[model samples]
Target: MGEPVRSLPHLVGRRLSRVVVLIAVILSGLLLGAGIEAQEADNSTANLPTDAESAVAARVQERLGTAEFTPAIVVFDRGGDALTDEDRDVVQRKLSELQELAAPGQQVFPVLAEDGQAAFVGVPISAETPEEELAEPVAALRDAAAEGLPEGLRAQVTGGPAFIVDLSQVFDGADVRLLAVTASVVALLLLLTYRSPWLWLVPLSVVGVADQVAVQVVAAATQVFGFSTDGASVGITSVLVFGAGTNYALLLIARYREELRLVEDRYDAMRRAVDRAAPAILASSGTVVLALLCLGLADNPTSRNIGFGGALGIATAVGYALLVLPAAMTCFGRGLFWPFVPRVGDADPTRSGLWARVGHAVTARPVVVAVAGTLVILVCAGPALGVKVGLSETEQFRAEPEAVTGQLVLAEHFPAGSSQPTTVIVATEDRDRVESGVARVQGVQRVESAGEGEGSAVLSVVLDAEPASADAFAVIEEIRAVAAQQSPGALVGGPDAEALDASDAAARDQLLIIPLILVVVTLVLLVLLRSVVAAAILVLTVVATYGASLGASWVAFRTFFDFPALDLSVPLLGFLFLVALGVDYNIFLITRAKEEAEEHETKEAIATALAVTGGVITSAGVLLAAVFTVLGVLPLITLTQIGVIVGFGVLLDTLLVRSVLVPALVTLLGRRFWWPGRLSHDGRHDGRHDGRQGSPAGHVAD
Candidate 1:
């Protein structure tokens, strides 16, 4: 019997070793497969949902032939002076040079502003030109404009093709910068949390691998599901994978450190930690995934793509955190904890630490804490009601790009919509009526017949208002109303009309998707917590946090950033991120509390759970906020606003709502908090299981 028992230890070690190797092989295979598939992935507008604007675009494409073309406007200004004959001759020569350089199927036309202080040459890109090939023609035009300009004259390119070129340049390597910043932030946080030189690299490396895999997976989704993807969606995927994966890593590692003090063998310690942490991680991830998946029901293709990509990222984060991280850490053994390694039989430091004191204070005056928290959140949320949605093209960028500069110069000397004319497609026979109706619209500066087909004709209506401004959208509505009376089948489309349609689609999506997301997330929390009351409380807390964040962000945007208006997509996207990620922290806290309640009375359990999970949750929250803040560095207003709103919201959830308000409510409703659950029926008297015997005095916890 002694001989067999002595061999048992070797047998267990061998089995554990085999398990680790198997996990590594599986992860490696997955990485290899993802890498290969990613090379063939497509990210383009070809997959955009057939919304109203898309239908208009399709009709326009059919009329114009298969080649997609965008106009490049080259604006030339001679300060505020009228053009002399010499200036006109110089500009005409430059325009002729530009026209000569135009590609096949392209056309260049020169128009002098009525004031004659500025003139622009409009160069149409060839329909045969691919998206990647647009820069060549735009570059040629710029180079042509650069040479031989007269004194006091300046020239720059703007308009659709030029804007695309500039935008592409701005986003070039943005993913790399975001990844670098996120990795650095997460690495520093992990190092501080563990105070170990080597421990941070393990989870960081795993998350990096997981991030790459997630990108490929999202790319795969775009190809397989016919969903559209843009630079914004791709950037968001990286942030989610890194931020969420690191968050799960922090929670699991923190719990593993605690379990190490209770279990002698590293393998057993890991098993116990994973078994205990998996539920909270899964519940949190599931809530986020379900909430994001609701975006698929959105009318906007961008929202659908973000929903699918974000959901996939959360799922991947959870998988690697629960599977790969644990396997890798277990293989590394006790040395992973380094200098402050936990020893078996050591007492948990959290039991007498800051959160324990905080828990006491919160429980002592639950009503005061709850009311104060509620009021603070409500005050912050009040500003959200005043939020205005819709950003003009000029407002989309934080700093003025060349395109915006050119547009401004053009606006100074010409009709605001001269560069981008609203196109009306009507029956050939009704063209005269449609053109007359469009000419009579309030903002219409001029109307011209642009092209004609077998049974249809295209009319270009130039407006006096900025093409992408609110006034322009209103004018489009009038034009549409007029067209309906004159030409029943007329299709109105242009840069301004497209913007209006997009804004309307976003508004519809918000109304349709918000309630759907709320329902889905609430159902998920109810199932995960197994208590309707607890789930409802969590939902309410997250909603309040979202509103507060949006309100605060709106103030920041107006006062600090000098933004004129919010991006059309910001509100819905911000809501999705805040509510989903906010619930993540709640799930972490409440799940731990539920676990503790099994062994202690409700009050003591709340105290113990808060004490044990406080540091890790706070660290995770800070890391996530920092990661999101990196989005601001990209120079896009939509991304910057989202970063601010979501980052601020996560901090709010961590420090106030999850820490104080939630615990206070749980304390005040002791046993009743978990109504209809076994814990409610099995609960011991409050404050009795632990050493405390009566109501404690209120005091702030760290």
Candidate 2:
């Protein structure tokens, strides 16, 4: 029989009152944290970070110290187009008006280019000005320019803030739709799984708190550290914070219910539940935070910012789960599972019937189950090898009217790669020679001669492809080689080439970090479960699922999105989510499986564990997927990619990893499902065996 609940005296509610007091202190601290940042208007957009903007800022700072510069509209007209004296006078007056309108960093420098075909206008973006504050100024300038434009002349505003604002308008509604669809699917799954109002209500309730806490923490961090958040990071953080936080909460709650059957007192049961699940929760959260932390390897500030924000979110989730959850459970007591099918003082049905039958069948034919499950995984995985990660910010605005108009305007007047590229700046002992040398780079399709200063000149070379493309990087290398041979002193720096270098380095970093995380996670599993083989198997499964998910994403995006493939970050992000969340599920299932097997046969244990935990995980996965799907509706390519990839991964984890792969693998392993552990033979009854028979070789719990 199972050991008495009190037999493991050390594991009981030791210092329960103190733990409760600690939770109270934490909740108070979190509340105090909330008040640290005064509530403001719902300027949610302003809270979003802009890594691209940060990249541009870094470049500008390098070029011209930390001094401010205003974004301006450059007007162009055909040469020799005679302007009436009145029109010329009007233009002159408007220029002065714009100059007078300038404020600190918000100044305008209006200039008509010497060719008369183009004019440059500069407007300073104030250091203190938030994004929303610039709209009126931008609109006023556009209206002023449009009103002053002579017939057949066109004016274009190309500046940092203007572009970001335009892009934001395009992506406005995208995230909402995706969020709605994802939430619906998750709620449906939850309803099916628990069929309990309390279960559904708990996740939804905790998700709100999680979302608020993450955003507030992120914003506060950025403010304190003087760091900036990009638009892409904001949406991705929201989904991750919500999905992962809710998943952790579910793990704790589900474990609590399971432990309920084995213990008499409600508080005592919760204490056991916390002790059993806390280590797994801590380990899983660590893996996720570590994966995100690894993103700091990228030189890209965007990825770094995401890593910071994401790490913060995961940390917050862990703290909240450990402290807040237990307190809430204690406060609610039995009512926590009330108005639902409470398992209070009752035997769980998982030990017998359908669960038992399936368990018995699996043990009887482990090879068949394992082989069939492998076949299914292989089928799903075959299409995944072609997965691609290509992202374009323009795609996020496809559903927006303003974005459509802006994109059309841009396409008509600009090359597809006009928005970005590697610019090779040539400076040499002899500037004339540098220009001539830069002109010879093979892949460079166009070169504009800039700054004919004494003994100095700059060459702006535009390549044939997007600057971030690998082909573009190759071109940069060739150009650098040519420059070295000819004008060796030239500094080649631009978004494209820099991004390529950063991307390559990040790729290598991910390779190193993936294995590191695996090892660490595996170690955690080994220590917690006391089974080396089980930990290895779980880790291997998670890694395989990641690869398969990536492959499938490549196919989906390539065929349907008509985009290139996936982003450079897909692999790392996929691994992070898959491994961390995958392990979370593993802990829930394997721990329960071990509990059952310790008192019964391996098959019976597997069956009972599946019945008890399978439905909850499936529901959690659905909810998590739904949360990610909301990102697909976001008007940004980055968010959409994250949503699709993470959503795909969660579904795969649920249906494949949890439902079939794990069960099949365990069955095949059989008696060795636990290699260095022995089954309990005592007739002492834990609630699991109250109404059920142990396997033939074992005595049932009394």
Candidate of highest TM-score: 1
Whole-model Cα lDDT of every candidate shown, in order = 0.80, 0.60
Among all windows of 10 consecutive residues in model 1, the one with the lowest summed lDDT is 1-10
Tens digits of per-residue lDDT, candidate 2, 1-702, equal 443232112222435645754665567458547754422221222221234332433344345432244344434333336445555565666676666546654456555534343444565655345666766766666666667566665555544456556765644553455445555655665566667666565555455456557767877887776545655666677677777777777777777777777666767776666766665566677777876776655544556677778888788766766666665665555655656544666766655545455655665676777777667667767876665443333343435433233333433343434433344444435556655665676667666653333343445566765435666677777777776566655555554555555555556657776776787678777765666668788888887777667667767777787656566666666677678777878876776677666555566667777777776677678878778777766555556666777788788878777766788788777656555544323332123555554332111111
TM-score of each model, in listed order:
0.92, 0.76
lDDT of 1 by residue, 150-175 (tens): 77778899987777777777678987
Pairs clashing within candidate 1: 67-127
Instruction: Please tell me which predicted candidate would have the highest lDDT against the true structure.
Output: 1
Q: Candidate 1: lDDT over CA atoms?
A: 0.80
